[model samples]
Target: MEDIVFLYRLVPGHVHHSYGLHCALLAGVPDEIIKRAEVVLDAVSKNNCVERLCNENISAQDDEYKNAMEKLLTFDIDSGDLNLFFEEIFSSS
Candidate 1:
């Protein structure tokens, strides 16, 4: 993951967010569940998600968010979706 991020930086004109999206997509996350999935990742381990986000200074584009999202949804699909966190995330901020 760190390697992926470093490469993203070395390459100019690349939006770092793309890396997140790539990750999400490869992890098999669905587009709809992204926000909740992000919230979950934000709450739990700050390792993969935050490190990449901060190191790259990237806020996800739809593509990158989706990428990170796919990873988020892979196993925790049911829990990661809006049906579970919609109210909490959107409602709070």
Candidate 2:
């Protein structure tokens, strides 16, 4: 959460917001279901984030993919239904 909040604060665009969110989810979540979620985020995962080293460029505009992610993020999952739930959004067990 700390890293995510910090990254999110540093970046002021939709693409970076999603990237920060991906870092939070991937870094914090358990291994079992990681691949499941990865399949969903695969569209946004590209270039290995080493743009300078690899000199690899990928477009940041994919509203269709982001819209799909928005559907995933915006859904209310019975509060603690999330295995990788955001702590700030959760109050109790």
Q: Which lDDT values do the candidates have, in the order given?
A: 0.52, 0.48
Structural RMSD, model 1: 16.9
lDDT string for model 2 (1-93, tens) is 254243334455445325534564657876534655555455455544322212223223344446546656886887645655444333321
- lDDT of candidate model 1 versus the reference: 0.52
Model 1 C-alpha lDDT per residue in residues 60-93, reported as the tens digit of each score: 3554666555544563654566554545433433
lDDT of 2 at 25: 67
Please give the lDDT score at residue 38 for candidate 2.
59
Superposed model 2: Cα runs more than 4 Å off: 1-5, 10-13, 16-28, 44-93
- Model 2 C-alpha RMSD vs. true structure (Å) is 15.7
Candidate that scores best on TM-score: 2
Candidate 2 residue-wise lDDT at 69? 68
After superposition, candidate 1 runs with Cα above 4 Å error:
1-21, 26-28, 46-93
